[model samples]
Target: MEKNKAYFVVILIQLIYTGMFLLSKAAFDVGMSTCIFVFYRQAAGTLILVPFAFITEGKDSSPLTFMTFCKIFGLSLLGITTSLNIHGIALKYTSASLAAAASNCLPAITFFMACLMRFESIKLRTSSGIAKFTGIVICMGGAATMAFFKGPELRLLLHHHLLPSHAQLNVAEGSGSGSIWVKGVFLMLLSVSCWGVWIVLQVYNS
Candidate 1:
């Protein structure tokens, strides 16, 4: 029963995440600045989290030190602000498809960062770690190829296109060459690094 409940919760979270992503992109599409959108997202989430944090950890928890609160706020700023701002700016300057593709490396990249930080073990002898490492390498190879290659042989997913979404974003309209494309890719790379660092820090914090 507990296992079933856990599985259901995972599925529910995924559905909610999809809904939120669509809503967020729509906000950005409808002439909202990414910073403002991020502000709203963080504000609303913090409001919800406050009660839950208090109810869950109010008792049996060590006294909250000022330093701890500051660190938490700092982590939130880095994770939510820097990450979202870079990603939003990147999306404006590039096709959503490429942005999505690069962003998809997030989970794998975060795990890799955790390993590099020694929060996670990187032993090839261990099947789990090796599996994770393989996934990260594959994601990186795919993303790097998409980012660096300018030749016909490397433009496969480019030609394939992303599945059309409700965002009404016509990724098909992406011009093959432009300065914005370079800027977007670079910004996404920065966002990816920040997100990975944020994940590593959170893991250690927990």
Candidate 2:
């Protein structure tokens, strides 16, 4: 039952992420400003989550020091604010699929950072180390392929027929700019790295 619950949660999380990517891309295609979209997105999350957090944990939460508060503020600025803004811009310039696929590198980036901080280690002589190294290589390769390669598009009647005419036109127009696509990929990777740093910092602080 516990295992089933975990699997269900994982599936739900994936669905949420997929919906976010698709909806954000659709909004950007319709000429929504990335900055404004991010603002609304963050505001909505705060409104929904903050009250629940207060209700659940407020009384039991430990006292926060000024230094701790400063650290939290800085981490939030670096990790959430900057990362989401860049991700929004990247989603605007690139396709939703590319942004979602590129995010697979988060574990690789986080592991590498953890090793640098001595929080984790790799011993090449061990099988688990070898597997970890191999996985990191594969993740990096996948992200690189997404960033640098653009294969021939598959134009199915179903694809075009399902989307509105304007959406179809937007799709065609969105994929035409190679330079901006490259820039967006770079920014997306940077955003992922920032998020990885955030993960590592949270672990370290805890």
User: What is the lDDT of every predicted structure here?
Assistant: 0.73, 0.85
How do the residues 2-103 of candidate 2 rate in per-residue lDDT, one tens digit apiece? 879989997898788888998898788778898899889989999999999999999999999998998899889989999999899998778777887877
Q: Over the stretch 1-206, how does candidate 1's per-residue lDDT look in tens digits?
A: 98799899977876675565555555666677988877787799899999998899888689879989988888878887899888887766554555656767888778767777877777788898789779989998898777655443333343443422423434423554456668778898888889889988987777
Residue 136 miss distance in model 1 (angstroms): 1.6
Worst 10 residues of 2 by lDDT: 158-167
lDDT of 2 at 181: 86
Per-candidate TM-scores read 0.70, 0.88
**TM-score of model 1 vs. true structure:** 0.70
Cα-based RMSD of the predictions, in order? 5.9, 2.5
Clashing residue pairs in candidate 2 are none
